[model samples]
Target: MSKDVWVIIEHQDGAPKKISLELLGRARELAETLGGTVVAFVPGAGVSNVAESLGSRGADIVYAADHALLQPYTADAYAQAVSQALQAEQPTLVLVGSTAQGRDYAPRVAARLGAGIVTDCASLEVADGHLVATRPMYTRKTIGTVVFSSGGIRIAVVLPAVYSVPPAEAGRRAEIRAFQVALDSKGVRTQVREVRAIQRETVPLTEADVIVSGGRGLKGPENFALLDALAKALGAAVGSSRPPVDSGWVSHDYEIGQTGKTVSPQVYLACGISGAPQHLAGMSGAKYIVAINKDSNAPIFQLADLGIVGDLFEIVPKLTEAIRQAKGRA
Candidate 1:
């Protein structure tokens, strides 16, 4: 078995992306157990300046493929680049973030090398000398563990925010090298015409350490304003169930459920949420779940770590005041 663990780095500027850093933390842990080294492979247009931080976050070596055509993420181009790196490096484990770009290209890279891959893996550890990944199944009704049966080299696409970002060690450094990718006719299948960047004003639920989500039981859209004070007190992001968004009370971006954004925060405050399977599928990965609703028989009580049976109007304001006073925020 190859003793080198590799992570594909994705970034635009000199800094590494959030998911890249998170995977590096996991790769570092895995490499230590195997007595191996961690390598970061960056394939894009002009990413040489991004190598140093990657090393500080636990990469032993930084291999970059800086080419002109690699700017806007194209699956064929990136797959070709990653496939070349795999052929040359022969790392035991390859971890990629399950971002939109990663989801598009990881499968292609696996196909190029005829390797098996698992997507959205939640956790991984060395078990019986093999890496075992744990994730949810049955819409999170159960946990499923996965292992690569073909079992030579493993490729895994990790969910974002599943792992915390690795702390950077300022003094650490890495030996840097560049990999070359040659794109032929087949590799240049699609041309990206434009890339639009959407700048939403709200905190992204995926990145929030704490989230406060309200459902239809909040009564109407206007009543959701009651949550704003509590969310502010806790320094948490505001989210909603589908009803508010469908009712046009809140924007669709704030919706959290199967049809909306999946979130895994440290603290999930589900106020007035009924805990539908679709809603649970999104936030079930949260470390702590607190549900506040008037109905003690609510389905949310089944999943909440702490259940508060009271009217949110009364409970939320008092809770907000308590948090503010406790924090000495006045």
Candidate 2:
């Protein structure tokens, strides 16, 4: 009777993505509340180990779809595999991380399965036997809670870093089932020629506990070195506004805004950024926000826990030095 919650896991280079575990934690909580089992769906080659890891986090069962054609992420292939799994398992709810891959895969799977899908949900809970999904709309100016009907099944794509990763339990056991699907490459438009990974330190913005972001206030790309140094001192990931990304000063992956990654880090430091509504929509979930800008009237200061009205050029270097000195004491 569709009594279990299923999660789709994403992996690269044989390693599971961090957001998958975070979604597992959320799914576990929901399953406990609804008195249902938490199941994980892993797709790709040699992913049985990753399926086991999902059990350690909280999955009650692991469904592994191992195929050579599934080695690389293709919308058609993944949708087909997940659709088959859903049809067989009859899960009441399906959860996926709203990462780049999930964004591409979840909708396709939902469309194929004829299931209702809610994307970029910040929070989820079961209310009166219905899954309630909370998501931002109108550029984060408004929040809406959606309740799906008792239709086929409910599927939700959640933003990364909105929830914490649950602790893994040693020696946890899950029933592992291997599944197979037929792939027809007919009419496939896109082909993967090569993949190049970006080298960076600290965690991904969505998974990072702390993020140090800069905006147009830094003046130009050359000044980003100061921001990077400060972020290093704080052991935080670096994020940028749309201007920096559009100017080619920073990679598009590092951009944080409405069209970019939505981060809920514990601490978000905005330097020289004006805090437009679009940008704030992505970072409003941060536990604490610190703004450093010369414009005291900047909208960013309205949401900041700590506001510094000064030239970022002068303030950033001093702050970096102070953090270095403080670290020395530790």
Candidate 3:
């Protein structure tokens, strides 16, 4: 197999996602250690524009796979096309972002190639001539070190925000090549005719720098307004533990736990959460955790960098006002 690190680029609104650029940055480091070049693969309809600028970000070579069937991002088409390309080139390592879209199709590509894959990797490095990944397992109770066996391609689905995006090097250029996947009409199983996006007041959980999350201590759906006020003051996305979601206090989009979205925000302010293992598994990667609960012994306090033992109903509003006033002064 060639010692080339390949990154599958994911884009939105005609630009590459932040996670994709992050993957490129990590790939550059890995390629150096492996004595290989960084290769970026952009698969979409009319994606030459998207593939062109990746060179400065770190890719030494770019393969633009443009086909009509690749549009609208059906899992079937992506899996088939990517698997076919990887099969042909046989790169040493394939890296994909562990977003919803990547989670949907990456496993299929791995299955097609019969390659070993590690998902939701926290860190990756070359150890003893093989790629090693650190992954959280069993609801994040333990972290396991994984090493790929010899003689096959390796794939890793990395979590977002784990690495810093490198500054683009001016005047650095890559060999841009057009790659075509022989797609059969019958092979494309799903068709997306329309897409309706939801209007969100805050950024998506995965992309948010700060998150204000609530749990069972919220008491009722109306109480989330308190969280909303706090979130607005802090310029943070609003999230919930499983209880609030199950109680119909909020939609699943606002949920953050093992069964919900995994986030690694710069700050995670968990209010009223008891810090269940499942809930901890999702947001434990946050840079700083602050918890507020009436119980001093609440499990969340153990993981919190700052713990407030008080009633959230009284504390949250005061905190929100303080933040708003602080912002006004700034």
Candidate 4:
């Protein structure tokens, strides 16, 4: 098909990023429904080797733009290359992962193409032949939906963990084509001197499907280990309420609330949490919620799909062991 959907591929240390693969998986379904082709577009140096990997995730073709200076991820280089691709290919929709690099570059590409753009989108659909995107608004307390009615190319940046990963097909092969876009001699003004990776959890918070979070009710900073152990047993990420973060019991990065990162995991196990409005704003969108608290009257129970009234100290370990045994049997 001539009309195509483009998924931007992001890679680091010669490995594809998780969020990009998620987009490709969802893009594949959309492409099939719309009777269009799925294209994976990669712009960086020495990226030709990743074409097959992209194809396995549902890309029919790989449009690779490799250049020496493009490896460092300058906004100017990526924007120019993607804009050039849109002009040459005229894709029906552009999908990008809402990551650090994407947050910077997607807007530039949108401005360059004069396309209607949406950021931090959590879901996508095609209705009435128009690309529509849904995103969290008002600090994630409300959902906002947008449709591209400009009759121009559509661009959207999807958030992490919004879609499940697609199974890989090792034998799949995609058509590879080298896309060329000459960079202006003075266009890229900034230089990336170095990139130092931060120490991250096994599963990043936003990318986690299941999360075990603690709050002020835990009583002590050291008690976080209880949730940590439970999280490890379930292969989940550990998160926190603002009180623990403010008390220095956990890092601010683990905090989930109005002032913290937004999460929409498949299952959110809130341990010793009171379900304050600020905290609810972040995780209320979870697909299923299980609240464990000593107080049966805790407000969190209102939003929880399942509620367990008891001391988390005694309950968490038992639950962890059950899950461990279940996994072992499986």
lDDT (tens digit, per residue) of candidate 2 on 1-330: 567888899887676788888988888899898789999999898897787777788889888899876777777778778888888778888999988888998898888778899998989988887888899888788899998875777889998877888888989888998877666666344677788888887678887899999998887889889989998999999998899999988999989988888888999999989999989888988999999999889999989999999998899999999999999999
Worst 10 residues of 1 by lDDT: 196-205
CA error at residue 215 for candidate 4, angstroms: 2.5
Distance from true location, Cα of 36 in model 3, Å: 1.3
| lDDT, candidate 1, 6-34, per-residue tens | 99998865777888999999999999998
Superposed by TM-score, candidate 1 places the C-alpha of residue 153 at a distance from the truth, in angstroms, of 2.4
Give the CA lDDT, 0 to 100, for residue 218 in model 3.
89
Candidate with more favorable, higher lDDT: 3 or 4: 3
Q: Please provide, for model 4 over 1-330, each residue's C-alpha lDDT reduced to its tens digit, 9 standing for 90 to 100.
A: 146889989987676788888999998999987788999999899886676578778889998888887978898888888888887788888899877789899999998878879998989998888788898887666789888887667888998778888999888878999988787748887888998765755588877889999999899899998988899999999999999999999888898877786787999999999998889978887899999999989999999999999989999999999999999999
Cα lDDT listed for each candidate: 0.86, 0.87, 0.92, 0.87
Model 2: how far residue 15 lies from native, Å: 2.2
Say which prediction, candidate 2 or candidate 3, comes out ahead on TM-score: 2
Q: TM per model?
A: 0.90, 0.96, 0.94, 0.88
On the 0 to 100 scale, the lDDT of residue 57 in model 4 is: 80
* Backbone clashes (count) for model 1: 0
Q: Name the regions of candidate 2 deviating beyond 4 angstroms.
A: none
Leading candidate by lDDT? 3
Q: For model 4, what is the error of residue 60's alpha carbon versus the real structure, in angstroms, after optimal superposition?
A: 1.0
Q: Mind sharing the TM-score for model 1? A: 0.90
Decreasing TM-score order of the candidates: 2, 3, 1, 4
